[model samples]
Each structure stands twice: as C-alpha cells, then as structure tokens.
Target chain A: MDTLLSGQLLFAALVSGSLYALIALGLNLVYGTLRLLNIAHGDLVMIGAYTAFWLFTLLSIPPVVSFFVAAALCALLGWAVYEGMFRRLLANPGLAKRVEANSLILFYGISVILQNLTALAFTSSSRGYQYLDTVITWQGVSMTGNRLLSLGVAGGICIAALLFLRFHLFGWELRAVIQRREAAQIVGVNLNRVQPIIICAGFAIAGIAGVLVSMTEQITPFMGFPFTIIAFVVIIIGGLGNIGAGVLAGLSLGLIETYGVALTSPGYRSILIYGLFVAVLLIRPEGIFTKAVRS
Target chain B: MKALDIIFGLALAIGGLLVPLSGDAYLMGLVFQLAMWIALAQSWSMLSSTTGYLSLGHAVFYGIGAYVCVLLTGVVPFGVALAAGAAASAVFAGLIGLPVLRVQGPYFVILTYGLAELVRNVVMRIESALGSFGRMIFMVPSFEVLVWCMVALGILATLGAAAVRHSALGAGLAAIRENEVAAETVGVPVARLKLLAFVASATIPGAVGGLALLRTGYFEPAQAFDPVISFTIVTMALVGGTETVRGPVLGALGFTLLSEALWSSLPQLYMIVLGLTLIAFILFVPRGLSGLADRALGRG
Candidate 1:
C-alpha cells in the first residue's frame, strides 16, 4: 500500500501511461477515419524499433534523430499499402458492410507477413540498445534518463496529435471522415486524399512510439502484437473514434496496470488488463468515455 | 454440381480414412493434421460463417478441452475424458455466449480475441503456480488410434456443419447475419439461435483438441492456446469458401498440403507465402477455392 502511493510508482505510471497513449492514438486515428483495423499496427512499431536499433548499431545514429527517419519510412509504407491493398477494398460500395471484417482479415495477413519477414531478417532474437541510461533523482523519485526522455517525447506527441485534431484544417477533415464517411464526402472532404494521409499519419505516430519503446525495453519481431492488443484496449476504454479520450484512457489504464501489478505479482498483469478489457466491453460496449465524442 | 461436390468430398474422406492402414508414420501424421484442421475449420464455419459474427477466439475452447482432457486422462477413461472436454467447452460457450454475442462487428471480433488471450494468460498463471512447466501425457493412444479419432471428428464436424447450414436454425442464422435487427423484428429467436450455434460450433474443437494433445503426447498452455490457431481457422474458413460446408474441407486440404510442401525447406518463407496467398485470396478470390470450384462446375 505504501509502495502504491510512492512517488516512484506515480512516475512510473505516468511514463507507462504516456507510452500507451502514444501507441493507442495512432491505431485510433487509423480506425476512426478509414475504419481499417490494422492488426499490423504493432508490427509497424516493431519495424520502427528495429530501424532505430539498426541505425544506432550500424551507423551510430541516436534514436532521438533516427525516429523521424523510421516514422517517414513507415508513412511511405502506409501509402503503398493503401494504394496496393486497402484502396480496392474501400472503393467497393458493394462490400461496405463486410469491409471491417475483410480489412481485419487482410491486416491479419499483413501482420503474419511482417512478423515472419522480420523474424527471417532478424533471426527472432531480442535486441536492445543503451541510450541516455543515466539515472536521475529529483523530488524523492529516480528514473533512467532514457525513460524520462521517452515519457516527455510520448506525452508531447500525444498532445500534438490532440491539438492537431482540434485545430488543424486537415485534422478537421480527418474528423469529418471519422464522424461520418458519407457526410464528409458530401461536404467536399476528398476521401481518397484524406484517407491516405490519415493512414500515413497513423503509421508515423506508431513508429514514433516504437522508437520510444526501444529506448526503454527489449524488442523482438513478435513484440508488436501485444502492443496492438494494448492499443485496442486503450481505444476501447477511451471510446472508439475519440482521440482526446483515448489519451486519457491510456493513462488511466497505465495506472490501473501499475497499481494492479503492484498489488499482485507480475504474472497476473495480463489477466488483470484483459479482465478489465472484457469487463468494460461487457458493461459498456460503446466505451467508458462514450459521451466524450458522441454527445 | 452439388452431387459432384458431395462425391468428391466423400472420396477425400475415404482416402483420409485409409491413411492409417499404410503404417507410414509421416503419412499418418500429415493425415492427422489434415483431419484436425478440417474439423476445426468446419466447426468454426458453423457459427462464424453462417452467422457472420467472425469469432477469433475458437482457440479458447480448444485449449480448455486440451487442458481438461489432459488433466482427466489419468483419472478417468480416455473416452470419458474426451467427452468431458467437449462438455466443458459447450458449457463455456453457453456461459459466455450471452454477453459476448451481444456485441457485433469489430467489437465482437476483438472481444473474442481478448477473451481468448485472457484465458491463455490465466492458464499460464495456473500452470506456473502449480509448478508444472508443461504436462506430459503418459500411456497415450497409439498414432493410428489418434489419427482415426481425429478423422472421425472431422467427419462428424463436417456433417454437423452441413446439418446446421440446411436446418431452420441455419436459415435463422443466415437471416441474422444479413441483418440482426430485421431478423429480430421478424420473430426469429436471435439470441437463442446464436447461443445454440456458438455452443454447437464449440463442441467438436474441444474433442479435436483432446485428440491433438494425445497425438503430441504433451500439453503446453502457450502452444495449446496460440492465437495463430485462431487466425489459421479464420483463414482456412475464408479461403475455402464460407458459404458451404465443403469449403473448409478443401481449405484444410489445400492449406495442409501447402504447409507440408514448404515447412521443411523454409518455414519463415512458408508463412510469408501463406500471408501473401491469403491476401491474394481476399482481394481476388473473395468467394474462396470452393467458390471457384463451384463456378468451374457451372453452378454455386
């Protein structure tokens, strides 16, 4: 109980919360605008981590600078994916009802391809690199500088994303698409252009988050699916299609996880998280933050 | 065309049944996998394809059955353990069906996936707490016996899927799939039928899982509840053609053969090829291999 209230746990919760929000925002953005459930979202993150890892390992580029490169790569990949695969599916009005399921299956395939390809390339071993690992102590709390940096970067990106959605013209167009696809088209929001942008932005955000993850944790080809699941839980908690609430919900889930794990052993962590997800789903299918965006 | 399909399906089943007689270990093993996947995919198709709910959590039922059957094998007759596994899964389906089936679309899909992962973690924790890394089943049935059991299950599951697809329940399920609200408005017992299908579709996988554990002579929670099993089931159902019972059989046959061909030489490459093939199937051959067969034979 004492440990639960300690400043260290609080700091840890904040950092983890920021990470969750970072991962979930990208997934929510893609799903909100395009209705594309990119189960491969996590694999995108994995790619970003690997990108940073290789850049630092081979070329000695710091993750701070390499993340942008990785994010750009991801954005390009997203554009190609949209053009090559999802565009045809989305263009078919006859498939409107089954689009979600179809996209889910398509992305599941994409995930398999990405994971196995990464495994083939990287040999399925875990990889990590040290950067800014010096411990810092302040106000009765201490953490590695890398973790502190990750927290700041993740939090900053999440805020920038929310602000972009709230104030930017393209952000408004993206929201228009999310709220009502047909209505957005009627209002002259060019879906073909807006959709690719949303997908790219979504991938870039996940890429950035992946870079932060690599800073603080070990990564492997298979690390992405759990993050995908985490993103789903976060978006569900925050209310689907609501970006602002997604951040808040991500933070809340982080606290829940931190405190829940503190109360029990580490092994019970997944059970607790998934239990919360199932409970929220059964009790409030729309979301805990349903009124945030809908009303 | 329908009669031709039936004959073709019967021939394949008879051919599968004869695999054990050859006494070749490799052939029996491959046939067992074919039968196992056929049963799993066919059972999955019964609920997901007909109803369009698209469950990705079928692995939970399979895992639970394997766990229970493995635990009870020493305590009870093997047949009883298998039945107990099936019954346990049916009960689990019935219990979760009410709240689970309430949601629709992507919610239903993710919820099911999350629940399966949840069960997996729970089982993992239990195993660790019990200090059992993974259980090794002793006095397991012979390879031929296990393959025969799996083949029997495959036939039963295929028959059950066909029976469901043609029955009043199947019609009601199709209506629900077309539109749940309208189906409910028209006096269909939507909830009851959905639950029945969910439970029915769940039973065979349980028994099939038990047979799988026996065949392997081991039980590990991670392997038993792997989400890849769920993904493969969905892929096979979609690839085979979900509209008819014959789709799953063909899909299982095709997928198993493909995997066998590629797995030994290059496993990772096989997965990549599978992923690409699945993508191609979705984009171009949405109706699946069975649908292509239907068209080639002049009718669907």
Candidate 2:
C-alpha cells in the first residue's frame, strides 16, 4: 500500500488520466451531439499512432509535428464516415427510432473495417520508436520526459476543449445540440453544419490522444479496441455526453486504476475496469457526476 | 407456403444427417460450424430480437459452458457434462439477468460487453493462477458424433425459437420490444419475461459451447471467451433478419458459407469484407436475407 501513495505512482496516474481524458473527450463530443456510439473511436487513435510513427520513421519528422497531421487525417476520415454511412441513416425518418441500435451496429462495422484495413496495411505487428526517452527527476520521483510532455499536452487540450465549449459560439451550438437535439433545432441551431464539425473534432481529438499514447507505449492495429473500452468507461463514469465532467471522471478513473493495480496484480486490470463499469451501470445508471439524460 | 416450409426443413435435416455419413472431414467441419452458429444466432434471437435488448455478451455464456464442460470431461459422462454446461449458463443468466437487464438501449449494450470482458479476464487470471495455459481434451467424441450433436442442438434451438415466436410468451416479448411501459401497463410481466427470455437464450449456447470445445479438442480462456464471437453473433442475426425464426438459420448458414469461402484465400480482407457487408446490409437490406426471401414470396 505504500506504493499507492508514492509520488511516482501519482505522476503515473496523472499521465494516464490525461490520456484517458483526451480519448473520452472526442467520444463524448460525438455521442453527445450525434447520438451515434462510435465503437470505431479507438481505431482512429490507432491510425494516429501509426501516422506519427510513419512520419517520424520515414519522413524524419518529429511526433509533435505529426500530431496535427494525424489529427487532420482522422478528422477527414470521420467526415467521410458520416457522409458515406450515417448521413443516409439519419435521413430516413422511419429509422429514427432505431438509429441508436442501427448506429451501434454500423459503427461496429466501421470498427471492424478500420481494424482489418489497418492490419492489412501495417501487418498487425507492434511498432514503436524512441522519442524523448530521457528521464527527468523531480522531488525524488523520476519519469520520462515524453511521459511528462504527453501529460501536459493532453491535459492542456482537455482544458482548452472545456473552455472552448463554454466560450466559443460553435461550442454553444454543440452543447445545445447535445443537451436537446429537437430543442436546439427549434431554436434555429444549424445541425447540418454543427454535426459534421463535431464529428471531425471528435476524431481529431482521438487522433491527438493516439499520438500522445504512442509516445509512452507501443502501437498496433488492434490497440484501438482497448482504448475504445477505456474511453467508454470514462464517459460512463462522467455521465454520457457530459463533456465537462469527462475530464474529472477520466482522471479519477486513472487514479483508481493506477492505485488499484498497485494494490492488486496487474493481471486484474481488466477486472477492475469492467467491475467499475458494471458497478456504475448497476448502481447509478444515470452516472455519478451529472444526470445526463439517457438519450 | 407452409408445405414449402416443411419441405425445406425436411431437406435441411436430410442434408445434415447425410453430411456426416459422407466421411469428408472438411465438409463435416463446415456443417458443424453452420450448426453451431445456427444454434447460437437462433438462441440470441429468443431474447435480443424479441425484446429489443441488444446484448453484446453472449460469449460469456458460451465461454462459461466451454470452461465447465472441459473441466468435467473425465469426471462425468459426455452427455452429463454437456447438460451441466447448459444448466450452468442458464443459472448464470438467471442470476445476472435481473440486475443486468435493468438498463436499456446503449447502456445495456455496453454493460453486457463489459461483463463479458470482465469474465474473460477473470477466467484468464484463474487459469494462470492454476498453472494451466490451456486445456486439451483426449477422450472427446469423434467428429461425426460431434457434428450430429451440434445438428441436434441446432434443430432444438430452431424449434424452441419457432415455438417461442408462436407462443403467448413471444407476443409478450414482442410487446416489450414495441413499448416496455405499455407492455407493463398491460400486464406483460416485464421483468419476469425478460429474465426468462435471457435465461432461455443462454442455455443452448452453453451446450453449443461445450460441443464446440469437443470439436476443437482444446479450451483456452482467450479463445473460449473471444469478444469476436459476440460480434459475429450480432452480425449474423442482423444479416439474417431478426423478425422471424427462419432468419437466424438463414443468417448463420449464409454467413458461415461466405466466411468459409473468403477466410482461406483472403484472410486479411475477411473482416474488412464482413464490415462492408454489414454496412451494406444495414443500409440497403436492413431486413436481411429472410426479409428478401419473404418479399420474393409475396409474404412481406
């Protein structure tokens, strides 16, 4: 238990928490506004990781520079996904009642496609590179500079997103659409314009998180599903569609996982995540921090 | 139409029986897969299609059955082991169905997925702690016998699904799908019906899992509880059309055959093709192959 309270573990938790928060932020945005459960969200992150890896290995460009490019690529993919599949489903007025289930299956298809396509392109092998491997010690706790940089960037982006949602006019429209789609439309919110952008932003954020994750861990075509599950757990903890609360929930879950794994064997990681997830669903189906309407 | 249905059923039964007699291992393997999937997809429809609750954790039931059957192999008769596996899954579903089924829509989907993953991880941990990497069975039944058992389970599942569809229980479950509040108000016994359906849907998969393990002659926790099994189940049910008992049978057969054809040569593109097919089905043929057949027959 002594290790649970150690500064090193605390720093580890913060770093992981930032990554979780960034991952969940995009999922929250997409689900909040579109009502589509993007099971393929993590695959976008994998694409980002691969993007950064290729940029660094082939082009000799740094990951920091590739981050934006990966994000843009993911955003473009998201737009294409919406335009190709979701737009048709959303247009069918008769299918409105079944959209959630329909989209769940559709996104599942997308997830499978993305995973296999990436596997085909990348050979399903794990890939990694040396970037900011230097260890920096502070207050008797040592960590990689890359880890610290990822933490700062992820956290900073989360805060920026929250602020943007609160302050930006477009953010207001997104929140309006999230809070109440029909009401937002009644109030003249341009959903056609807002939906596409939010979906793009969601993918971009997921891509950014993927780049940050690549800094600290190995990347593979199949690495996306676990991250997708993690983001789902975070969003569930924070209350679905509550973008602001996702950050806090993500961080808290990070602490819980880090400390909980420290206390128990690392093999129990999935148990802890799924146990926490199931417990939350059973105990508070409405979520802990906010009563986000179960749309 | 009813006579044609009976003829179709008779022809399928005859084919199932004759396949094993042909003594072709590869063909027997394909038939076994088709039967197993038919049982699984049909069982899944007994709950998810009927009640509008899309569960993504059917693999949990299957894995549990496989684990239990593998453990009980030498200690008990094969039939008893299979029955025990089925009973275990039924009991497990009955225990969790109440609390787990409380959530609806997307929450239910996510919770079921999480629960399956949790169980898979726990099983992995237990296996490792016990110093067992994977279990190998030596005295399992022959392939022909295994295929016969699978065919029986498939037939049983199909009959059960058809019975449920035509019964009052089916009407009540359908009512729940249409509108749960209204179903409850109209005295459909919502909670009890949901649990019953969930347990019923789980039982055959357990038996199927046991038989599947026997067919493979090995059991690994990861392989037994693969989430891909759950995804494939959903895909088959959707692709076959969920509204009729015939749908799952059609879906399982079509998907199994398609996958069999594609997996060997285009292993890399298999999942990609499946994904694209799913998207296409959901977009254009939302009702699935059975629906298309119905329309062709002027019954739609």
How many pairs collide in each candidate, listed in order? 0, 0
- Residue B59 of model 1: what lDDT? 98
- Tell me each candidate's TM-score: 0.98, 0.98
Regions of candidate 1 where Cα sits further than 4 Å from its true position: A292-295
lDDT of 2 by residue, A84-168 (tens): 9888889987565778888889999999999898888888889999999999999989999899889989999999999999999
Clashing pairs in 2: none
What are the candidates' interface root-mean-square deviations? 0.9, 0.9
Per-candidate local distance difference test: 0.91, 0.91
Please, what are the lDDT tens digits per residue for candidate 2 over residues B1-300? 567666876788679878999999998999899999999999999999999899999999999999999999999999999999999999999999999999998899989999999999999999999999999998998899999999999899999998888999999999999999999998889999999999999999999999999988899999999999999999999999988888888889888988898898877688888898889999999789889988999988
The worst-scoring run of ten residues by lDDT in candidate 2 chain B lies at B1-10
